[model samples]
Target: MRLKPRQLEAFRHVMLTRGVTAASEAMNIAQPAVSRLIRDLESEVGMTLFTRQGGRLLPTPEAVLLLAEVERLYIGIDQVARAADDIRQHLNVVLRMASVTSLVRPFLHRAMMEVVGPRLDLPLVLDVENSRHIWDMVEQSHYDLGLVFGPPRQGDLQTVHLHSSTAVAAMPPDHPLAEKDVITPTDLLDCRVLTAGRNSPLRRGLDRAFSQAEQAPLNTLETSMLNCCHFAAAGMGVAIVDRITMRAADVKLCAKPFLPTIDVSYYAARPAGSRQILVLDQIVERIKELLDEDTVIAS
Candidate 1:
């Protein structure tokens, strides 16, 4: 039994759209043409792939199984298209990477430039996402590399430590604690505080510090680490953030050392692929160097 590309396309579209009419619209073809393709495909496969139900076409078990294989094929087709595009653009190499949003500007750019300088034609697809999503994206092979705060926990990833720094407290310029060179957890007593979300390593350390003081912050707002400075500048509360996030010199906010310091680790993570890209290695090396410089400056 031979299956034509149009027949498979129609079957895939109907399965995705769940109706001949919708599939026709999606594929920019007439409904009759779509139905004919599906019919031909079913005939070739010798199985009824869909059942008509109340104006909606539901996939039978065979159709569901077929669609899985079709989807895998589509993924390969997409990769081919991407490679063609890279060649068309005259890119020497293409590397897809992702990182937490906060690192996009101050961190990722610097690292990338350090490695790929003067080669602007080299294509780099960078996905900016939250730290929580970085691991899953890398593990799924959605991104070739990921730069993120904290250690890599997933078993599928090969991770390297890039930097380590202590947490710092950020407050509005005029906040009472701003006058202090180093503000400890107790110094924030009776004050509203902003911190990383509950699952964050930084938040865990902040919680421990407050617990040691036997005091709960008067109020707490949990948010992205990058937003901590924004919250502090807005006078929402004092924010606890990593040294990387705090290293920015902001006139609107004052950063001070946190007592009972919490250590934050940054890692360069990649899926354990059979082939490693040399560019990815260079990027990680640049990141390590930059972070080391930042540490020396802070000290």
Candidate 2:
């Protein structure tokens, strides 16, 4: 039996909110109407979608799997609608972009907003994924642009340098090392080092710095989450993090420039033959403008 789009929407809402009352509020419908929609959907599918236990709605495995597909369908529907609106208004095409987690929060997103401002009629779709995941999506032509922390070695992709910044040693404000204006890798040899996962470029730089100092590999605490590195530094463990990450006001971490700075580069990559390369080039230019502005103001 084919499920109606409205029924699928109701199912997704219930699965997301996990409570009929919450789903009803979100859908802007009465609770009884929401319940009826769910019941109809379950009957049409010939299966129980959610399990009720202790007043909590738990999704069955089948329902969870279906919810994932429904999310993608809805995202595509939204994109189509926005594209139509953009065409009607004679607006520049919306460029779908994806970026690694490292550039998500304050860098790439900020730069995009500054570049487009309120002038663009089409909504830019930005997806944040890990570096490897973003590259895979780029290979599939799922995104027009991909922002990554490191260079792309593949021949099929063309990359343009966007910005570069040096990594700094971060420590809690009250930590002993915070008193120093500049920190060296040797200074951290005896301290616990908080770093990103082994595969991340930031971690690779940290490793190289220690190797150059001829120190035993640091007592590393590896984490995949960038926020965890911030917290680790705030809690007294020394972390080598990009300058943008050290700027969080709530972190209470003092950043000291590394004696031999580790340079990190950001690149915008696009399929070499894709027509969307023009959009990527525009974005890369905007990124350079912002970085240059920051450098001039700082100087």
Candidate 3:
């Protein structure tokens, strides 16, 4: 004998509420109809599910086991219903992204404008961190997408090179070295230099350039953010940063090509073996296009 949907629903409600009256009230049906559905469910399963005691119904051991399975089935059905609702209303969908601080304002802003429109009504969860933190979060699967610079970490991650950018020396327009088309390590020797910390690849590359040039850079401040460019624009010191960091047209700073160029390659990374999401893939593509366009314009 086949069990009907009403029979299973009535049985589940009774098992949950442990009372026929409550089950009937919950299902918006008469108590007699609830009893008939429960009776039909028991007959279809060919087992006695409950026993009457003191004007109350007590579930038998078999009924308890059956109720566990019925709850699991209902949970699956509820999930399907929620998924359908989300599809209909475009709810509960968020794109989680992690990126280095420098990439957040310029790179991501341009990519979002190109891919998701400038208004960006879609739910986007963004985390700004250092390059190392971005890589670690993406590697651990805490972030759905990561934008970072330099070589990507190996193992358990899929990376695609977005583009490469060379380092630039940012200085106030009136700074003495700003007259030079390209700033050398020797040009930084006498100036108070704003630098990235030792953890940054650009810092290490610059250190090597200084070593090879046999000049000592007088580093006045060390920071990880692109704010160093703003400081340079404010005449604090000469700041060496990625070319992208100098792209803001309002900064009023001269970005000169740095000598012994440090080429930092940016990458779009995601956890390996994760299911491909269409939106994330499109975002990656848009970033690549924007970066390529910037490269062309710079050249």
Candidate 4:
């Protein structure tokens, strides 16, 4: 009794779609052919994998257990294929990277492209979200590496600091504060400010800075996207954002160092007991080198 690779693929697809008709359509095969494959597979294994009810395929208990094992097997197969491709092309291994939304474009994406070179045979699948979600995914081993704006304060994770940069204030070119070499919390007392949402690290830092400075808080327009804040800034609102974000915007905005500069350090992180730490370390080191190169070129 041998279950072939094609049978396994059919079973996995049926389980995923939970409908033989849809699975058959996806596989570009006739429904009867899919049904025959599943039947043959069950006969060989001596177990009923699915039960049909209300025209839907429902997995049996045995099928659920088998599905988990099958998923792992497929993942291993994928890794093998990817590894072979990398070797054939003389490329670094493919890495799955996740990062907070704000850092994805200007920081993580650029740094990786610079360090990994323009011809990337090694692919990176990037997931961008808020820091909390990124941390959650990393802890669950959903990503090979994670880039975060600040150190993890609550998670049991391993981290390597990539680099630190100062926060800056952005405003439209014609805005009053745009002419300043630098701006302080006191200077923004009555201004309308655009910022990332309250949960963001940048927002948290700005709140603390304002509290310490004892300045009245400005009216804040909160959004989760750094780009949106930049857009608002270009529309005549003052925005306090990381320098990396400000520099990437295409709007007519001026960026100035924020007084008592809010410094941010980005870190690469993975779960504490991860076996893939070596790969993540390589990525972090490469990013740091890229940042150094950028600094040298700019200077």
Candidate 5:
């Protein structure tokens, strides 16, 4: 009835990478050894975890359920490792935060430094991920806090609004649309626009704007809001997303107002179990102050 750590590890990697050979490489073991581990795990669970289909290992229904549980188990294991790190360093608490890329540098990092400044040895793990991933990390209690796109969908997360801004039309400095003070969907009729993917909340808002103009986005590229600027700067298309992405992009891009604006907001979300309340409060306040002063957020 007991499942071994190596067995679970092999099963999880197989489910994630989708092949025994790939899983073996990831676990730094031989391919046949991976097959044997999977077989032993299947025996322990008494279920067929995978079926071969077109040279791919496809998870069965039971395997899918096991994968979810296995993932949670791994998350717990990761938390334990972090705890061990904290103890090894003889720290009372460590700050683990995840954030969207747009929220860093001139914004979140400055605020974080002001709070944790004096403690040079203080362990801080700041992970930069997409907002969707940040949301999940905070909700799962993997991180103490997360700065992400607003309107927290998870009921358990306590959040405070940090900033709000309108989406903009971003393009290369010399793009035709850059000539307009305010770019609308009609202005982009002949252009290939870049926009958030269909699954994104930003996409829904952008779709409404296009609908109001009675125009299709003409956007052939569906990407992350962050990538909109990068893709547009390459002259692939015009970007319509939060201004921060355009300003945050490594390459230069021009951001202009978008007619029929799409508003976007970011918030600080955290679970109730955080011990760094004073530091969190200070960081939140500092971010709000920076948001007010940072012209990049004034879009």
Candidate 6:
């Protein structure tokens, strides 16, 4: 009863694709061949992997447990293949990075340009995702690193605090609140407020602030903090956003220090035990340098 790689691969594909026909196409094997592999795997493991129902393969309880282990195994194998490709030095080593949209444009882009040399054709695979998605990708080892706001939601991740900037109130220069040195929820009582979506950390904190002031965001418009700045600049509404995102946003707006000094933190999250490569380390350092610079515009 020797377990084979091909058997596990077939089992994995079948479970993933949910049918032998699709699994065969994915693995580039005939339908019967895929079926045979599954049968062999099932016999080797002594369990019913799947129960066929209406042309779909429904995994048994045992199969579900095995699939998790198989997926983890394949992730390691994929990492090994990538390492081998790096060793071969055929093309430039691909750096897979994922970050929230807030950091993608001016911050991460600039960091990569500064870190990756001009003559060196370092390949980059970047995904602009939400913080949660970026966290999952980096934790699952799908990405080399992830840039996210606040600490990671999941546990056992190594988080490097890149920068901490106080949140600011953004508005058009012509707006009346522009005269104020500091903007508060009370100041925004008459103005349309563009803010983070409800339940988000920023939103929750803002809600608390508004509660303390005995005020609410009237004429509320929900959007990301980056978009909040851009929209506010376009005269849509005043926005409350971190100085980092405000600085990064390519817009002309007045950024007054928001009241109560709400601080936002950015972090680079990676797998807990993963080893840092030289190229990634340099990119991370460059990002740190870029963030440390003050580029926020307050008109």
Ten contiguous residues with the weakest lDDT in model 5: 272-281
Residue-level lDDT of model 3, residues 1-299, one tens digit each, is: 77788898999888889999999999999999999998988889999999999989999999999989988989999999998886554456677898877666666877776777753436778887778888888888888899887777879798989878788888888999979999998888788888887878888888888888876776568876377888888888999887766664238888888989887778889987866766778888887887788778977
Candidate 1 displacement at residue 286 in angstroms: 1.1
Residue 87 lDDT in model 6?
A: 51
lDDT of 1 by residue, 1-299 (tens): 78898888899999887789988998899999998899888999999998988978889999999999999988999999997886665455667888876566566788877778888777778887776788788788778888887856858688989888788888877888888989776777777788888877788888888888865666888888778888788888888987677654243777788889899898988887635677788889887888888788868
lDDT, candidate 3, equals 0.82
lDDT of 5 at 193: 81
**TM-scores for all candidates?**
0.64, 0.60, 0.72, 0.60, 0.64, 0.67
List runs of model 2 lying over 4 Å from the truth: 1-94, 115-123, 248-250, 276-280
Better of 2 and 3 by TM-score: 3
Q: Candidate 5: deviation at residue 107, Å?
A: 1.5
Stretches of model 1 off by over 4 angstroms after superposition: 1-94, 118-121, 154-156, 248-251
- Stretches of model 3 off by over 4 angstroms after superposition: 1-72, 81-91, 117-122, 248-250
Candidate 6, residues 140-217: lDDT per residue as tens digits?
Answer: 889888998884466888788898777788898899999999998888989899998774567777877888887666
Evaluate model 5: give its lDDT: 0.82
Which residue segments of model 6 deviate by more than 4 Å? 1-93, 119-121, 152-154, 295-299
- Residue clash pairs of candidate 6: none
Query: Best-fitting candidate, measured by TM-score?
Result: 3
Against the correct fold, how does model 6 do in TM-score? 0.67
Candidate 4 C-alpha lDDT tens digits along 49-168: 999888888899999999999999999999999878766664675567787765665656666666665654566678877777777788887877888777565667888777778777
RMSD of each: 14.6, 17.6, 7.5, 14.2, 19.3, 15.1
- The ten-residue window of minimal lDDT in model 1 covers 243-252
User: Model 2 reaches what TM-score against the true structure?
Assistant: 0.60
lDDT of 5 at 179: 83
Q: Provide backbone clash counts, one per model.
A: 0, 0, 0, 0, 0, 0
| Model 5 TM-score, 2 decimals | 0.64
RMSD of 5: 19.3
